[model samples]
Target: MTHGRSSNILFIMCDQLRHDYLGCYGHPALKTPHIDSLAERGMRFDRAYVQSPVCGPSRMSTYTGRYPRSHGTTWNSFPLRVGEMGMGDHLRPLGVRTALCGKTHMVADRKGMERLGIAPSSPEGRLMAECGFELWDRLDGLHQRASGKQPTHYQARMQARGYRTDNPWEDYANAPLGDHGEALSPWHLSQAHRPARAAERDTETAYSTDRAIEFMEDAGDRPWCLHLSYIKPHWPYVAPAPYHRMYGARDVIPVVRSDMELRDPHPILREFHRNRVSQVFSRPEVRDRVIPVYMGLIKQIDDNIGRLLDYLRKSGQAQRTMIVFTSDHGDYLGDHWLGEKDMFHDCAVRVPLIVMDPSPAADATRGTVSDALVECIDLLPTFIEYYGGTVPTQIIEGKSLIGLLHRSRAKLREVAISEYDYSVRKARVGLEMPVADCRMQMVFDGRFKLVNVVGFRPMLFDLAEDPDELRDLGADPACREVIVRLTRALLDWALRHHCRVTVSDADLQDAIGGEARAGIYLGCWDQGDIDQIIRSGDSGY
Candidate 1:
């Protein structure tokens, strides 16, 4: 395919949003018309999975097109090593400028940047730039902890807008009003029902959306990839005004869980269920109160998406821009008796993936829903292919969805992989295990999902039979064959992805007599070479 203006990419990422929450994904109540419109105009991936089920590692995979193990950013707050290349590094050479407008959850490799002498103020030193993006507005969205003593830019802006308080972000944006009209911080689950004191235009979502629009407007003739990352629907569980009132407990979907899941649950599952956060979510009252606000946040995101799309159409960029909508990872929201994201359950790993390629070639597949196994890492390669750039097969561990978008191929991979390293939270959860034993890896084929945990029994679920994942067949003697098959498949996947840091085996084999063999001293290249070697040896002796 030839490169054109249609190659521009608007990569929209929401935080901790579940795949099934959107209206297009068959949500029974929540009406996400804007997001649904994107799905209707593009390809909706029903089985898309993130590389990791956490924020940082998942976003790292999305930006770098590498697995968490490959990139070495295994969890939130973990830095992506300095040498790892991001989409910007790959796309910039091809004249595609990548920019970021919102949250990246990127923990900079200060040591790497220091060794390389890349100042934080420099283009390559900025958080967004570290991931190969130019920063239009880099807002990490958490005002409470903005790099030690610094306040978040969003908070600063809110203060500038006269929403001043000791901590305006928390007091006005995240906290709800008490009976006496005092700030009720979100730490209390009851605050989930309270509407944010911040005005609609001052919310983090609104700020990100406005900044994204500004960046798109400022982007010149050069093809650009704007990562419009929103930090909403994540935490504090509060929405502004009408969105907060848009839904109540009635609108929330029924939690997909069963008491059977808790009976003799896996050790990790048991620990997670007993965790304070999970315990809170385990309550029906908490779920009823919190889920509505969560839904409200999603509604706000949908509305902002509508605004962004409207801007694109009005500005004539709609026809030429490829719009990608996805989340870093899914939120559990009490599903499976867990809250927040960290588990291998589909609620935490599977995310909404809708790609609207504006090229005329995509018309045939427009509004098509694909059940192909796709990974978040694939976005990098997809953008590369869209812009006529070569996919760095050696570096990127994902396949481009160009074929699927163009209806050239029916499927991409046989199975999707997701990994989580919960070692950092082991101590907090009172687990007295070594960090190495605190991790879990999951592999899901279309019908079956297997979870492999270090120092723990593996979990197997037949999605075909138990879509809710209420049953554990890991210990079932009858399910031994399925377990073995999945274990072997996981092993194969690990073996294939292991030790990819250096030259691949294929490359090494291909270089048998190539430049890799250059300057080598064979037994005797020639009589003259032999004579020179003999003379040199005699002189040394």
Candidate 2:
């Protein structure tokens, strides 16, 4: 089937952004007019969850349309195995070109690539190619302390622009001025509140936005998918001069935590709180200082999104392109006494999902909001379906969102799941737990969220009552039925979707004709059946 000219996709992803930080998602002070514009003309999901709460695994799920366990890339820097079909693989056959302009956080499976004899210098061997995307202009945009190591592409560009420090990415882009006129490093937890020394145009967000525009302008008349991934609002928590001063202590929201939450917390939660990330965020003074900078970074991202949207409209691409704005995951920002994302709290797992389909068919549901339980993995299938491509259900586990986009009330899924494997971090932190015990999985069934750790007690929260997730109902005897129901649901989900990469029993039965096989074995039972089988054998059975 031929796809329409409006089948182009602009998949925008921001790092470590929360759902409540956007104006469209009901943020009171944050000005995201550009992102809000997308919501005004499209469908916004009120309850969207990532497949995982970390960058690498979450992005893997997005690209592959499968869970982390299914893809085998469970954490940051983990490689997606070679030969695994991704969005690009599925879309390219349907005449859509898939390209990435910015960060993918995809560590190529070096071993697999080598075993398959794929050259690293070849287009098919680069990180983009391995992940099923063509490399338009790759820039991960992270260059903190790469003194002796090879600098990132963004850092090289900074040097070419006359920012000539040993680590300009850290000094000019991430550091703030001190009282003595020195570069106060952002890595210092106390100095994370300072403004960045780099100019607004020189920031990573600006660079990524510019590159994305270049890709869009150069894409001529073809249905293309460009992943305009931006590495911002993630860490270094610093923004350029005006954006840094955009918010202050007055704008900071109060940290969400209580004494009751700390009391008899789960072992994993207790360990996380003791970690450096949680320890720094738990302090009142630190929260007061850092939250504002984090807010500033998000505002900068919003402004950049505005710039990109304006360009698309001016270029006449806005009417034909399907714009999807979302994040890999979210930051804790002192929520539930955590800083970086690791656990399964709403702050870390739930992200803003805004999809704007520009086709005339989608006009009826424009600006509508859906409360369906959506996951990040659903995007690939959605893109496939939008391009009029057949979704390879045997490989892609996620259901397409076409029904939801059309304003259908029929539910695509009843539960969303997220998993994290913290064994490496646990071992580094000297935690006295088994390697398998460091993992955790979360299952949310629209209302209740159940977090099951490998070797610890489960944690449950009734989102209807405790949206903050401060109260733990896992230990309550009255909520045992709820726990049992969700647990069984999660178990059934895992069992059904586990790594059965090949054809199933039903598929095999259908592939080889059911009655034909039986008739072939019945040698002397029926002369008529035997004759039919003998005749079919000669006709390429």
Candidate 3:
């Protein structure tokens, strides 16, 4: 395939959206018709997983096509190193104008830039600063912390719309207005059931949708990729007036957890369950108060998706533009006696992935679902393949799913990997562990999932038999073989993905006979060998 000159990509990402909540994914109550249509017109991956369960590291892994271990930004606030390349760094050179609409959770490597003496005002510095994205409207994470002391685009828009509160985001946008016009803070779970103080159109979700459309209009006729990211369904659990009344406790799915999971919990998870978020979610009423609003936020996201799709259809960009919809990670929402997405349970690591390739080549597999194991890093290479760029295997560890999107999957991956660094999490503090020892690795083959901690025994779950993951077989002598096999697989995976980005497959292959051809033949003793080396152009011998 050559460069897709007429092709555009709408990469839609939502924060903290789960796979099971969408209509197409078999949700019983929530109706996400717009998001479901992506599956009907494209491919839905049932077993997609993120590299990390947090925002920054997972998004970095998606952007860079490398593991969190490989990229080195292992937590939420950690900065991506200066040398790491992002999706824009790869796609921009190929004429795909990559632009951001909402949050990337990107923290720039200012120290590395200073050491290299690169000015932040320079083009290269700016690219590194924004994780290689050409910004359109960067409403990153919150109204206040978009950057240190810099007022955000969302804040200005809110204030311009007559919301003159001290903190418009927390007060007007996220807060609920009482009957007497008093502010009911979203921080309290009791007030989360009421509608937000702001109007539906002025909420961040609506603003993000409008700004994405604006970005597309500005990039008319150009081969561009608009990363239409939304910072909703993530936190504060607040929805605008119209959506606030959409659901209640009756609409929320029954929580999938068991008391048995709490009895013999792993040492690491024991501390995690004792944390505030987990303890708060562990209650039934708390879930009833919060989950309905979460459902509303997801419904709000689905509606915006419909608006974006409608625009694409009307503007005639629907036929040529590829659409990839996914989330940074899954929200636990009290699934396994946990919350806030820090564990390797399916609720935190398993994410939704749907891709629609608007080419005739994808006709055969359209509307089909695949159980093939996938990682979020696969998106970067998929974009590269769609744009006809060679995927540098040395730099990108993920395999492209273009083949799967267009045709039958040739083979299944041996295992899917995910990791979490609890160094910044309260779990580490409660346990009083060193930063270096505050991490855990997960290796999940098609059936069994194994998590290896620094000093504790491995935690294993047989997903095939125990889909709810209510039981742990790590301590059972009967499951010793499964543990040993997965441990070996993990060891092999870790050793192979070492820092070898500077070395390519061709470079390593050439080196096999390169030294002998260079005529410094260490083992050559015969005159015929020396004569052959001399007779060769370079290595004809």
**75-119, model 3: which lDDT tens digit per residue?**
987999998999899899888899999889998999999999999
Those runs of model 1 whose alpha carbons end farther than 4 Å from true positions after fitting are: 127-129, 143-153, 165-167, 179-181, 427-431, 497-510, 515-541
Per-candidate Cα lDDT values, in order, are 0.84, 0.83, 0.87
Put down candidate 2 lDDT per residue, 1-541, tens digits, no spaces.
Answer: 2238546899999999999888898877778888898999999999999999999899999999999889989988877888787778888888888998778888888787788898887877874444988887666655235668787667778889888876776778778867776788778867766667788888888888988898888888888999998888888787787887788778877677888878888777887887788878888888777778888888888889889889988998888889999999998888888879989999999999999988777788899888989999999999998888777777888988887887655678889999999977753255677765677899999899999987667999999998899999998999999999999988988888557667555576555455555544533566666676667653124
RMSD of each: 4.2, 3.1, 2.2
TM-score of each: 0.92, 0.92, 0.95
Say which candidate scores most in lDDT.
Answer: 3
lDDT of 2: 0.83
Candidate 1's error at 540, in angstroms?
A: 30
The lowest-lDDT stretch of 10 consecutive residues in candidate 3 is 141-150
**Residue-pair clashes per candidate:** 0, 0, 0
The candidate with the higher lDDT, 1 or 3, is: 3
Model 2 spans with C-alpha error above 4 angstroms: 1-3, 127-130, 143-153, 179-181, 427-431, 502-509, 512-541
Q: List clashing residue pairs in candidate 3.
A: none
